[model samples]
Target: MDLEKPARPPAAAPAGEGCLVVAVRVPVRIVVLVLVVPVRMAWDALVVAGRSLNDTLLRPLGRALPWVGRAVFVWPFAGLWRYVLVPSGKGLAWLGKVLVVLPAVALHRHVLTPLGRGAVWVYARVLTPVGHVLAAIGAGVRTGALWLGRCLVVVPSAWLYRWVLAPVGRAAVRCAKGLARLVETVVAGIGTGLYRGARILLVLPALAVWHRVLAPVGRVLAVVAREVGDALGHAWRVAGYVSIAVGRRLGTLLRRVFVEPARWVHRSVLTPVGHVVRDAVLRPLGDAARAVGRATRQALAAARASVRRARADLRRTLLGGQTGAERKPQLTHRREPNGPRTRTLDGSTTALTKD
Candidate 1:
């Protein structure tokens, strides 16, 4: 008769847990693991023993085998090639070499070298002595000739000039001095008279004419010429300015009439025409080329794929399917662990371990 309202439905078990739960459960896999662990431990012990044996004893021999192979088998060939084969080949090569080289050496020693020696001896003994004698005789003759020229011709010429020519020259110079003194006395009187007469007759009249008449005329003419020159120069400068202005106007007119129209035609008409041609003809060509290139690449890829497939099949057949082939994406299967799978918010199934 005392019903406690069913404990008020357990008061909603708080916000985190709906109800209290307590259970003693053991998984079947855990029981299986209990049996598997002993066998697995024994197997692992055996494997560890084998690995220890391999590491301590067998792997050392494996490591040394390559070095032994190199030393025992390959080293003999290398030594033979270097010591025996190479030397034997070189010796055999000398056997053939003697055929040509011995004859050449014999010819040089017997015929050619003897002739060369005889010619050298003759040049050294006969021709060299003759050349030396000729050179000495020529040198002696040149020295004698130079001595004769100096003593015979040069000394006599100097002596004759010293005694004979110096005395005659001194006598002639004394006579010329006496004649020059008498002529100078007469010429001085006549030059003084002529100078006074010429001054009165010519110089005074010329100076009076130049100062009274020519100087004034020249000044007037200079003034008129200066004025005319200034006017002409001004006119020339104005003409030059006019010419430059006209040239600039003509240049501007020609540029507007010719260059601008040509530029406009090229910009508006020819450029568009060229672009249209390129788009029509060249663009299609370029597209076709690209398409051909793409097709070629695709064909090469397909051919390579087929070749790889053929090679894979051949290997599989030859090896009796021992060639491990990669599986396709959908055909792949994985034996999952015995753990819970949680569906993530992103809808991917993720297996959570028992940790």
Candidate 2:
């Protein structure tokens, strides 16, 4: 809404009144300058000077001091191996020496020492007496067992050996002698005849059969096996030759059917098709895609420029500048002659302008 003022003639204030107002404001500003302005200016000047000094001189000096010392002073003496590495090595050695002993000492004082003492005390106070008593008891048990074994087992076994086992053993010996004599008599009467009968009845027949029957059969079977093996060897050789011929034919068939035909089709058919595709399809499609990408990029750039301009205008407005009075550039379009036409997303052909 326009708050339109009615047009009227300007009313002039008296010159004296304007002069009086100026006069009053001038003294007040002078008083403020005397009181507040000097202090604030002093503080701001000091802060700026200090910060500038720190940034330019102090910071550079601080950085240069370390670099200069390391390069000039420290590095010059760093090559003295004894002065540099020896002290550090000694310090580390001392540290390791001290630290290693702490654990060992702690173990001996807190654990091993107590454990050894406890073991000695236990052995002296408890196990020593117990071992003596155990030894006495063991000795008594051994002596008693020895006495019992001699009285019960040894004496009784001796009596059994004298009274029962001795007589039985003597009778067994006599019986064994009589049995031997009888065996000798039987051997003399029948052993020779039996041996001759076995030779005639079983051994000689088996030997004759082995020599006449089994041996001849084994030789015949061996001859038949040898002939069969020879025939199988001949058949295997024939099959191997036939297989070699068949494999050669198969190799030719496979080459003609698969490898050669595949190569021919790739050369005669696929190559031409690939050229046609590259020319008719891929080239035009790539051109179209590049054109579309350029158009999209141009549109996006324009939108971004517009957004940036809007943001700048908004910032100016926020910073107390007049917002509505900023002159915005207008886009204009002109038609081109014999130029490639660009289509909008909506399929409209619009004129384009450079500016």
**Which candidate leads the pack in TM-score?**
2
Model 2: per-residue Cα lDDT over 225-276, one tens digit each: 9999999999999999999999999999999999999999999999999999
Q: What are the models' TM-scores?
A: 0.38, 0.42
Model 1 Cα shift for residue 223 (angstroms): 2.9
Off by over 4 Å in 2: 1-172, 187-191, 307-355
Q: What lDDT does each candidate get?
A: 0.88, 0.90
Summarize candidate 1's per-residue lDDT along 209-272 as a digit string, tens digits.
9999999999999999999999999999999999999999999999999999999999999999
Report backbone clashes per prediction: 0, 0
